[model samples]
Target: MAVLPLRICGDPVLHSPATEVSDFDDDLASLVQDMYETMAAAPGVGLAGPQVGVAKRLFVYDWTDDADVRHRGAAINPTLWIAPVPAGDADPETESEGCLSFPGERFPLRRSPRAILQAVDAAGESFEVRADGWLARIFQHEYDHLDGLLYVDRLTDGHARTAAKVERKRGWGVPGLTWLPGVDHLED
Candidate 1:
């Protein structure tokens, strides 16, 4: 498998929502393989198709602590279920985050602690998985990318500003605000 170049925050393709996969064939399998390779090479826990200029609803993630876990392969076309919204006056604490597309930048953002996901493997077999902790957050984050949502969009003013500060400290500039990919221009 070959590592694909990651698209940065400004790319219009990254803003667009991804198209659903109509056929789970050899090409899709190859793409998933490449995604896995690319994610591993980046040394990130997750990577999505849009990050590589592919507008397909696909992503690969490996949240295991051991590098040997890569031998288990990747998750394709995963479905995600986030925890219910917190009740009134409750604080949703922010968790540190990083993105494959935005290399060299890291920030804290709020996210649910748990999630359930289902997806088909490269062979078209379905599997369901439940995730919590960092794995859950990673799943939700990457799944959002498939829908053209970035972690920054979920941030409130204070968090966004804090994240921006961290980004600046790391010598990263403000990301270009643009329409979500695959969405209508009007919505953008």
Candidate 2:
């Protein structure tokens, strides 16, 4: 498996909606394995297909909750059903989120505290997941990638302005942005 090149925020593939996975074959299985390896190399809790320039509706996640239990999962053609964050479920303050696509930047964004996701596995088997707390936030973040959205895009006006300023300083928001797994500079 290879740790594929990550597409940056301005990459067209990152902005375009992904195509659904129709064939659950050896090729698809290989892509999933590669995605898992890439996510691990990124050291990110979650990653989506478009982040790796695959333009497919898939994502892989391996995250630990506050209780120290590890939860690992992969979703293909996922449909997320998010639940409203109740008055008591979480602290009212915004939560911080980072992405492999954005690399060294982390931003605070509002997300539901719970969600129910229905998706299929690499073998085309169906499954449902109900996640809450930080895990739910991870799911929502990755789900947004399938629709060409970054967590920063969900920020409020003030937060978005701050994020945009940082993005400009970082030399982002250009066409054809690409980077190696560990390299900060854009690739040719």
Candidate 3:
């Protein structure tokens, strides 16, 4: 497995909806493996296919919950269901999240505390997960990537304005920009 180059926010692939995986073949397996490697290299809990320019409906996650239970797997052609997010402003300290595409930046955004993820493995076997807390947040974040939406797109108030300004200042939201995990030094 290799650490794939991650597409930055400006990349069209990151902004476009990903296609569903129809062939559960060796290529898909390799992509999933590489995604995991890239995610680890990015030091992120989750990474999506579009983040790597694959434009496939898949994401790999490796996050250990507070209970010390390790949750690790690839969700290919996944369907996610989230409980209604709580009403009111987000708690900046607890609700903030970052994306591999956005890189190094974290913003406060509201997300459902619980989520149900149903997807197949590389081998085409189906599985389901009922997740809560940070795990739920991870699922939601990655799922958004499949639908061509970034966490920043879901931000509100000052956070939303700040994200737009950052994108403009950095000259992102275009196409063909990417960063190699562990190779480039990025400051938040």
CA RMSD of each candidate after superposition: 7.6, 3.1, 0.8
Clashing pairs in 2: none
lDDT, residue 153, candidate 3: 90
lDDT of each: 0.71, 0.84, 0.92
Q: After best superposition, candidate 3 residue 84: deviation in angstroms?
A: 0.8
Q: Which structure among the candidates has the greatest TM-score? A: 3
The parts of candidate 3 lying over 4 Å away from their true place are none
Candidate 3 colliding pairs, count: 0
TM-score versus the correct structure, for each prediction: 0.77, 0.90, 0.98
Quick one: best lDDT, which candidate? 3
Per-residue alpha-carbon lDDT of model 1 for 111-182, expressed as tens digits? 778898888777878888787677778888899899888776677777778766665564444344322223
Candidate numbers, best lDDT first, in rank order: 3, 2, 1
Candidate 2 local accuracy as lDDT?
A: 0.84
Q: RMSD to the native, candidate 3?
A: 0.8
List candidate 2 stretches off by more than 4 Å.
85-94, 183-188
| TM-score, ranked from best to worst | 3, 2, 1
Query: How would you encode candidate 3's per-residue C-alpha lDDT over 27-135 as one tens digit per residue?
Result: 9999999999999998999999999999899999999977899999999999999999999998989999999888778999899999999999999999999999999
